[model samples]
Target: MAEAQEDEKVGGFLGWIERTGNKLPDPVVIFFYLALVLIAISVVCALAGLTALHPTQVNADGNPLVVMSQSLLSGENIAKFWVEMTKTFSHFHPLGYVLVVMLGAGVAERSGLFGAAMRAALGNAPKVILTPMVALIAMIANHAADAAYVVMIPLAGIMFHAAGRHPIAGIAAAFAGVSGGFSANILPGQLDVLLFGITEIAVEGSQLDPSWTMNVAGNWWFIFVLTFIYLPVIWYVTDKIIEPRLAKTPFSNTASADESVQDPSAKLSSNEKKGLNRAGLALLLVVGVWLVMTFGPGTPLIDEPACPAAVEAEGQCAAVQRLAPFFKSLVGGFMVLFLGAGWAYGSAVGTVKNHRDLVSMMAEGMRDMGYYLVLAFAAAHFVALFNWSNLGLIFAIHGAAGIEASGLPLPIAMGLIVLLSATLNLFVGSASAKWALLAPVLVPMLMLLGVSPEGATAIYRVGDGATNIITPLMVYFPLVLVFARRWSKDFGLGSLTAMMIPYSVWMLVTGLLLVVLWVFLGLDLGPAAPIAYSLPGN
Candidate 1:
């Protein structure tokens, strides 16, 4: 059968989406265009002396700050720009994250481990349950931080292919749950630490209780509820909408339909089953080693606070901060886990006859990243230049201030916090960094209006998670595109963004409603954390 035109098959709004989206330039070129546009914007703003109050930033005397734009064409910056070109590309976080994960992931793929496991367990995984499972797992994967992007996403795509479905749908499902539902994990994690820590700094001189604590799990119950609400939406979009549209368009990057496995539901061979059993053992061994390393020594895997006396006396942390090192170390943990699992399965099944095969497998994985590396370089430049220009910070401050000036109802104000966070998330990809900027403004302002600081923090979480899937400026955005490209090499940035816009919009609207209702119900955000704020005398 001929490859059908995507726009022709999807009628009405979807067709218009496909048509308009496909008209945009390739992702690489688009980044370059964005860089130029950013430079122009930065220069204009700098000339106009447009500035904003830097919320968390302080000077030598520790007063709040006024941040001005950094003009790209200024003599000082223009010279520094040429000097930092190599450093910009090299320092981009996703560049390193993806490359490192692939070092092991590539081995897993080439060693025939993923294939055999798919044959063994893949055939048994119910197609109907796949979307929900991927969505749920992706949401919880925030515990592993950046590893979700590397491990779960590609694994989702492969599983989809084995199950005879569009692999991009699998990527979308995982991406939605992982990035789009980022704040909705059942487990409270370092994200809780990072954001609440900023919240603490935001309230330093406020009139409320000087000793009021900032709990890491303050939003735990709220986010826990959010996870369930998000799961069904992700399932519906991936299964009901995206995949059906995708089925009409053949994946251009992968093997032809006939050349691909026709009977994806084929039963596993006895040997493959045995290999899977060993793979499970290998995975357990990896986890076991990490556990032993964590508890076997004098808390070697976890970092002990230097000021333990001070920490405990503050009545904070909700628990100890000993897991900081372990949390920080998960990136490496994921690498070793994949490397060990792949090697174990490969050895059990004879795919790896010797150590040389492992070496070759690792190399093959890095080799596949050639296109991704180029894309990352351009994206890094775009992001770095944007950061250097300080437009992102200015834009965020402007957005936050606009909502405050609107004098909307408290519920509406909360919703705008979500919206502002979502919008700024596009420009400044770091969750902690953005929160650091907004917390001082949002948390205090909300408190004066009788919205708990925790409540304000929770609303920010909603906004940050909503639009993550749609933004290319997100450090992980290019990484996700590479995941989609594996199944459809012709899939462009616009294609990914277009497919994701529905998810973003739905998540945003649904999330807004959830926040409004949660506040109305006067639910406890977590232990001792309330939906309302109060002043001492009032």
Candidate 2:
């Protein structure tokens, strides 16, 4: 009854959000509409002579170059759009990155390696530390991508039930870590590749820093720290807040006899054990290969020979330039790791008898991405249209100017960015889609204000993650609700949203504080990625 009152209270605001959000069109349709709006706006801005002083470019007179907004509705732009439509979608920066990663991820997930690995991590955890253990594994399981939601959430519920705790508490902890801590993983994964790929495009389009390139590990340290920060947050929220609230909520045993037969406490079978062993070996072998390629023989991943003589004469090549190849190679490296590990594990467990099965798994993964492909097409055109119109850069320059004139501290400015991202997440759930729309403006705007693109990306991630669990718009929110319903039949959408509210609030606060601290300390975002950026001439 207390839980009912609590749900009603929180549901008022979130209910409005859910209703309004459901009324909106699909993300792909949203992109198409946004593109149409951008065209109209571009026509108006161009006719009104909107322009900005280019930050990096100079005229023949050595003055800052003045850039005029171009109308996307113009004959030239319309022609270009029609001619380049295919190229735009095909060359979309994140398209290949996500597809490539999903190929390997599909095999690993289908072969049951990802599920077994998550189960193994939480299988024997002590009751005393079960919340933290679930939190930790949930964060790490982000490498499994969307599979984490399917495998970990229910498994956590079962594990908690077996431990005599409220299963909802377990589900909350796992959901918090999986979605709320989405970007807080120890190792760089597909999200890094996807977001940073967008960041790279934004930076290049802005022409803010010609030297800036995408580093998949650019947020390694930030996310590594975030993992620890979120671990305690989830642990405390689960044990101290959510569990107490859920304690009186009666759990209805909804499982069938066959479903109940698969006890989570049961030990792994011999085949599962053998598969895990082989998977570990295969993973290590992949790492070993990357290590040798990076550090041995000619050091192929390093570009010492390509160092400019001006820098080489000073002693060594710039670290970032030298290690560029290694960073670019990590995308493929991760694919190989998942592919090899899954294949090895599947072979040991009889999931993969030959190459045909492996190919089938890869194809299945691609099939899962059909929706993303359609969304990507619309998003690619929208982004390309924005870039061609020159409005993204114009707005960024003007926005940066306004921010600078306000005399706001950089940390405060970044905190606002995080807030903006969190608020937007309630409305727009796809991280890549939101980033696609925001990056061209936010990345370049922050860059103009002396914040690194990486810094902007990092903060955006923090905001994007914190509100995911509470937002009905998030693609997997319904799936998570279904998982919760299995343990408690009365668990409605409001119940799930209310249960996750504390996690969302705490995570957003914690993440904002961390971003502020990171900016004030001037810490590196990742290897060779700083929190501060400067225009080249500056």
Candidate 3:
């Protein structure tokens, strides 16, 4: 037994190096290093008189690097520096939005909603389809925020075990969908809308493309195509590659044991049966109401009422326009949706007894997220610091300038941006923050190269999505750590990294190819979305 324990420890350590030796630079150490370097650069640039209010040289290649000095820093611009810093720390819209919804989702999960619903939902699907279907379901559940992380990853083991398949494969498949397939989706999600809004903000900031706009479907057409591409790739990697490697191991878990041991004698009580009916009815009502609200005229579900008189008098476009906020408010919107759903389900299902119970459910939700929220706080602040330093902008500016100098055609340049995103994903993981930092530089740079904002944004999404499965900095990486432990007792961070590295490599290659193909085909990302440069200032 001692020998086995020692073996596990040695194996775990070796595995860690084997997997993460290439990527696990101590972020804490790196943070301080980058901060000092950036401060020095800022100080030197200031001393050298190279500080500009804005980086405004158009068509200039190889702009000389200037060290920033202290005197060049302004008290007025101090506010702007802090604001940019804050944007990094508080950059993730999906993080907050998902957490808010998870509060209610937590309550429902605590109340046995997921297990009950899953049993009912998958009662009849074939075993072969179970793994992929779980992946697909988790993909859909992203609309509910991070419920997939809370519910699906662990449940995959249980569900797969019941079907007499490898539970690890199940977990891998689901994890692949949730994180690996991060950016590709069949439907428009809150992240889609949020990223699009930021992309538009970035394009407008560049002044090279004021007319460029990114709608909700900016990446939809390409993502939808990639969904088919991803499913097969994920399934092949899991079933063919990952499963074979794990089959030699004996780290079986008990999570799936219960799923396979269902007793025929066990049955729902009369009250339980009635509760199920009520829950079903409530779910139907939710779907019905949402449809009505989304489609009905004068319903105010989507947009704010247009005050044409005010617009005409002020000579301002409707800046605070309708329904636009709903898309932006996805987190808050989902919080209410989950809270309402949990309450209704609890009451109808006789699980939630009163208002106290409802509050408890939300509290329970927040409680489950103690670790997650903390990580988010750290991630937010780190991101904020990166932004404040403006290093990301410098990198993007230099990169865009280099791409232009390469004299690459529009299609190749777009593809290169996607590749750049995948490479950048190695260190930075926040999509919005990275895009916010990158877009300001790349958006206008690409416009000058004759790529439209929507096209540039789409390429960015492909790189961002493809790298998610592999990056340790990805917020969900720790969760994937726990998932890996189910299959191998010695599994730790390195094990998870080893398991996912293949998927990341292949997906990065294939995803980039797909993005290039989209550009080649001259695809419309959405209604009024164009693939190439529109008439200047259109």
Sort the predicted structures by lDDT, highest score first: 2, 1, 3
TM-score of each: 0.63, 0.96, 0.71
Candidate 3: TM-score?
A: 0.71
Model 2, 30-69: lDDT tens digits are 9989998999999999999999999889999999999899
- Model 1, span 112-200: residue lDDT tens: 66655534433456787988887887887765555567666776776687677788888899899889999998866546755665565
Indicate the residue-level lDDT of 47 in model 3.
59
Instruction: List the global CA lDDT of all models.
Output: 0.72, 0.90, 0.61
The order of the candidates by TM-score, greatest first, is: 2, 3, 1
Task: Please list all clashing residue pairs in model 1, or write none if there are none.
Answer: none
RMSD of each: 8.4, 2.6, 6.4
Residue 58, candidate 3: Cα error in Å is 13
Best by TM-score: 2
Give me the candidate number with maximum lDDT. 2
Comparison by TM-score, 1 against 2, better one: 2
Scored by lDDT, model 2 comes in at 0.90
